[model samples]
Target chain A: GAGVSQSPSNKVTEKGKDVELRCDPISGHTALYWYRQSLGQGLEFLIYFQGNSAPDKSGLPSDRFSAERTGGSVSTLTIQRTQQEDSAVYLCASSRRQGEQPQHFGDGTRLSIL
Target chain B: AQTVTQSQPEMSVQEAETVTLSCTYDTSENNYYLFWYKQPPSRQMILVIRQEAYKQQNATENRFSVNFQKAAKSFSLKISDSQLGDTAMYFCAFMKHAHNDYKLSFGAGTTVTVRA
Candidate 1:
């Protein structure tokens, strides 16, 4: 595809329910990133993947947040037992060749946990 | 840890005027990247400009330019000839020099209002 693509433009789930957000990065991009943005807050880094290896998961707030990238092309961010505070926009971005280039972003998925 | 800071919470500029947005970052690494991104009502974020830490000369993209003071750890963006379309939330971000683990640390965004 020409640009990064994300699924579920908007997702609304119950507080205890689980949800998964998906990201399909630009073809040939090896570095993928996931970020969370709350209302009136900065973009918070969540996870990063380079090729098939993920070296950083320090930004994930708690055990409930997890992300995986398979085949080096698609990634998924899963939230277990979602909390009301989890409501925010989840953004996906990809960089070429291990952060040698600028990151291109996708239209994020806005998740609302009621 | 790398951290970006944008002190001004909100700013307004008249159309056709020039405005400067301030940003400061802290990092021990010598090689890194600084960026300015704009997000309007639409959810997508657009890159405005970038500055490579090695380059002393600031980067310019059309009406957008940056004043990068590496010693001061400041990367401020200057928008020349502001237009109504420039109104958006501006975010300053930083990335380290590490490979396979480059994560962006962003500052609280600044709301820019371009007035007619």
Candidate 2:
């Protein structure tokens, strides 16, 4: 893809339901990242992948939030037993590589837990 | 943990004029990077500019420039000749230069409304 792509631009799910968000990084990009933007808040880091390996998952909010990347191209974020507090925009970004390279972002998935 | 702060919750600018947004960060790492991102109503984040910590000279991109003060831990963005299209939420971000530390710590963002 020309840029980072995310599926299901908007999602509205009920509490206690599970939701899965997907992200497709740019072609040949080795570094992918996930972030959460709450209402009127800054983006909070969730996780990142470097060549299909997540070295840092410390930012995941809780045990209910989990993510996985496959073939180093696509990543999925899964939230189990979603809470109303989980309502926010889920953003995904990809860079040519880590370090000083700037990451390109997707339009993001607005997940609303009602 | 690195923290970025944008105290201004909202700002108004006249078209064809200039507006400056303030940002400050706390970090102990010597090598790092600073960035400014813009999010419009479309909800897509676009990189406006970036500055490396080691660079003494600030970074500039056309009408967008940054005043980066490493000692003060301040990185301010100056949008010259603001346009109506520039109305958006602007965010300041920080990233450490260490390996596998690709996560960006972002500020609360300043919403800029460019009025004609």
Candidate 3:
């Protein structure tokens, strides 16, 4: 992909339902990250995957939020039993490596929990 | 943990003029990286400029530039010859230089609107 790609650009579901967002990082990018942007707020880091290493899950807000990257490329973020507060934009970014490399981002998926 | 702050919530600029957005961060780490990102209504995060803590000189990219002060913990972005396309939300971000620390801490963002 020329840039990071996210699917289902918009999602609307009822509370208590589970939702999954997908991300396809730029080709050859070894580092992938997921973030959440609430209404009128800055992006909050959720998870980071660097190559084959165990993902850095320190930023996950709660147990309901989980993410996994398969084959070190495509990543999926799943929210279990979504709450009204879960309504926000889920963003995905990828960098050539990690460290000082600037991450490229996708347009993001806007999740609305009604 | 690092924290970035953008005191201004909104700003207005005239096209062809220049505008500056303020940002400050709190960090104890000496080695780190700072960045300015622009997100328009389209919601794509675009990197405008980046400054390394180790570099005393600021970073500039065409019409976008940053005034990075290490001691003051401030990284302000300046847009020269602003264009209508520059009307967007600007974010300030900080990242640690450590190999294991790749996540970025971002500010609340400042919304900039350009007037014709």
Candidate 4:
């Protein structure tokens, strides 16, 4: 793809339900990232995936938050037992090889936990 | 730990006028990168400009330019001839010089409204 692509642009789920957000990074991009942006807040680092190596999950806020990237292309962010506070926009970005290249971001998914 | 800060929560600029958004960051590492991202109401984050810490000269791309002060730990963005399309939330970001890694630390965004 020419740019990063995200799925489910808007999702409204009930509290305690599980939600999944998907991201398709640019072709040949090795580094994938997941970020959360709350209402009127900064982009919070969530997780980073660098190739087939072990993903850096240090930024996951809680056990309910988990993510996985397959074939180093598409990534999925899953939130189990979602709470109302989880209502926010989930963003995904990918860089060519990381380090120096600027990241390209997707349109993001607006999750509304009602 | 790297932290980016944008002091101004909101700013307004008339069309064709210039507006400067302030940003300050804290990083222990000497070699790093700074960036400015614009997120419009459409929910897409667009890269506005980027600067390398080692470079002394500023970076400019069309109507956007950055005032980078490495010694003072400051990186501010100056938007010349603001337009209505420029109305959006601007975020300042920081990333360190890690081999094949681009993890960014972002600041709370500033909402800029370009009035026509």
Best by TM-score: 3
- Candidate 4: the clashing residue pairs are A99-B101
CA lDDT of B28 in candidate 1?
A: 93
lDDT tens digits by residue: candidate 2, A1-114: 788999999999999999999999999988899999999998999998888464589899999999999888899999999999999999999998876467899999999999
Residue-pair clashes per candidate: 0, 0, 0, 1
lDDT of 3 at B9: 98
**lDDT of each residue in A15-103, candidate 1, tens digit only:** 99999999999998988889999999889999888876644799999999999988888999999999999999999999887776578
lDDT of 4: 0.92
Per-residue lDDT of model 1, residues B1-116, tens digit only: 88899999999999999999999999899999999999998878889998889999999999999999999999999999999999999999998877555788899999999999
Better of 1 and 3 by TM-score: 3
lDDT per residue as tens, model 4, A31-95: 99999999999899999998898888888999999999988889999999999989999999998
Per-residue lDDT for B31-107 in model 4, tens only?
Answer: 99999999999888899999999999999999999999999999999999999999999999999887745688999
Error of 2 at B14 (Å): 0.6
Q: Ten-residue segment with the worst summed lDDT in candidate 1 chain A?
A: A47-56
- Report the Cα lDDT for residue B8, model 3: 99
DockQ of candidate 4, scored on C-alphas against the true complex (2 decimals): 0.78
lDDT (C-alpha) at residue B41 in model 3? 91
Q: Largest DockQ belongs to which candidate? A: 3
TM-score of each: 0.96, 0.98, 0.99, 0.97
Candidate 1 global lDDT: 0.92
lDDT of 3 by residue, B43-65 (tens): 98998889999999999999999
CA shift at B78, candidate 3, in angstroms?
0.7
